[model samples]
Target: MSAARDSKSLSGIAINNSPHVQQLQKTAPPHLGLVCITFSKEVRFRTITRTRYLQLPEEQRETALKVLYRENLQRLDLALTFCVRNSIRLYRMPSGLFPMSDLEDEIGATVLEKMSADLAKIGQRAERLGIRMVLHPDQYVVLSSDSPHVVTTSLKILDRHARTLDLLGLPRSSWSLMNIHGGKSQRADQLVGVISELPENIKSRLTLENDEHAYSASEILQVCQRAEIPLVFDAHHHICHENLDSYDHPSVAEMLYAARETWANPDWQLVHISNGEEAFGDRKHSDLITAMPNVYREVPWIEVEAKHKEEAIARIASAGFF
Candidate 1:
């Protein structure tokens, strides 16, 4: 069978045939949010450029990046506008770029300043529409790496980004949600200290997520308690990490429970949902909104990370997330 078909078949077996799936599906949570990333077919820069410099002319790359950035902001504005028109309450801002290292050489103090100013313009639009913009940190920043320098450099970069946020004069709440992947084992302790040492304002906005391997929701909660940062949970990551034996389908209830127990309150909790087959991992454009009860009922934001934004939003809207 083709990969897509194989994946779907696996998901069907994991969910449709499982008794646990039926029960969890029936017992939908009361308060949930839908937070989706601002992504579109025409707007993603990640696949467009292999190397930062090659993406555009050296002299014009900055301008090009800014233009691309604005296009994404506009796309986000349109998405939020749609969500508002439909009465959807929550949405996450495009992290704009991923893996801070990708932009480290490309983005300097001047470029960062410009990006921050531009973000302010985007934030204004979102604020006017009553939308929230959560800035996600790069995914590859492994806090638990044996390489101490990597953690330090990542923190420094994050600090620079925080300063840019301050420079933009964006309200703390709007740009406050900075998501990071808490690294594994001993690395977590060191990263926690670095996170704790951050300036009070920046630290207040930091949130750590549970990844597929490095940490569990419960483990991250412990780290958050030490660092005093908030916790964000990716439901899929928990299931994949825990390898829970009780259910064949992803357990929305268990995921929610993990977040609540670890994070203390739902207000500080954020959830990420995406569609994927167990065999293929997370499919680029698959839709799993229907599989998630909290997404349809309680969560404030559901950021759809799909192959394309149009497909992602259309699928979520069809699932009644909006």
Candidate 2:
């Protein structure tokens, strides 16, 4: 594949020494990465509690959460180390890193503060390693929900995520974006209105993504334009929901280019790439990316959201798709 138009500068690959870095240095974009949850038999790492906090005795809930939080942060440190060693520059953190922060409001702040130093250290390490770290809260976090309670809880979750990024000393910009999908299609307008009122913490670093269901790329682009937040274009999601077959398809390319405009920083214009399972299961990310739409070769950063994590990334490289 030919080198992307501006791949070298965008992927931060000029100075790296690892052999894996060579793969990135090739013609396509240099920074190709995977999301959270490493699948390694030797490591056996997990950033979540083995037992649910609420299931514990009431008196023990606080203590359990503390232990879980500490372990999770420690695992995050390990994960960061792994990324640096492997020359993986972009990563999406697992939302469970701070457990119960949304449901148990009173204790969440205290627990997060207690781990601030450690979290900051991890963030600093990531910066040093040239890793572009990000987070995606689960489906439950819907800022556009019709229910006030859902919106309220969603903000808390988003606030916690923003605060976590703040603790890492990440700037209030696209570099440390906390991305979310445009919620139910019917509420796109409502979602934008609610987003306008969010505090600077949640608003400044927020991003909206196009999901396979509900909102199409065009729909989310409107929301992103209105909210002035970056839009994360997902190739598979668009193909499945937007009726676009491949990234290089003329119509799909137009929408992808439009989505690129949503990003304020061209250096951090992150996109997602994945192949679906079957026609009926198009929403499901396959274990390996069988093919990537040719149009993605020049994008700044593409988060490989396959079930196989790093393994899928290796497969993509082997296939010479980029």
lDDT of each: 0.55, 0.74
- Which candidate wins on TM-score? 2
TM for candidate 1 is 0.68
Give TM per candidate.
0.68, 0.86
Among all windows of 10 consecutive residues in model 1, the one with the lowest summed lDDT is 3-12
Cα lDDT tens digits, model 1, 33-70, are: 23444333332333235365465566876665555555
Q: What C-alpha lDDT does candidate 2 achieve relative to the native structure?
A: 0.74
So what's the TM-score on candidate 2?
Answer: 0.86
lDDT of 2 by residue, 1-322 (tens): 2122212222222323333221112255647775877666422334435356556777776777688777877877777777777777888888777777756546756777887888788888888888888888889889888889988889888988888889877878888888898887778889999999989987888889888888888889999999888898886788778564444445455666778777777667888887766642277767767666565666778898887877888777666565
After superposing candidate 1, which stretches have Cα over 4 Å from the reference?
Answer: 1-88, 96-108, 112-118, 167-169, 173-175, 245-255, 261-265, 278-285, 293-298, 306-322
Candidate that scores best on lDDT: 2
- How far out, in Å, is residue 163 in model 1? 3.6
Q: Tell how far residue 102 is off in model 1, in angstroms.
A: 9.0
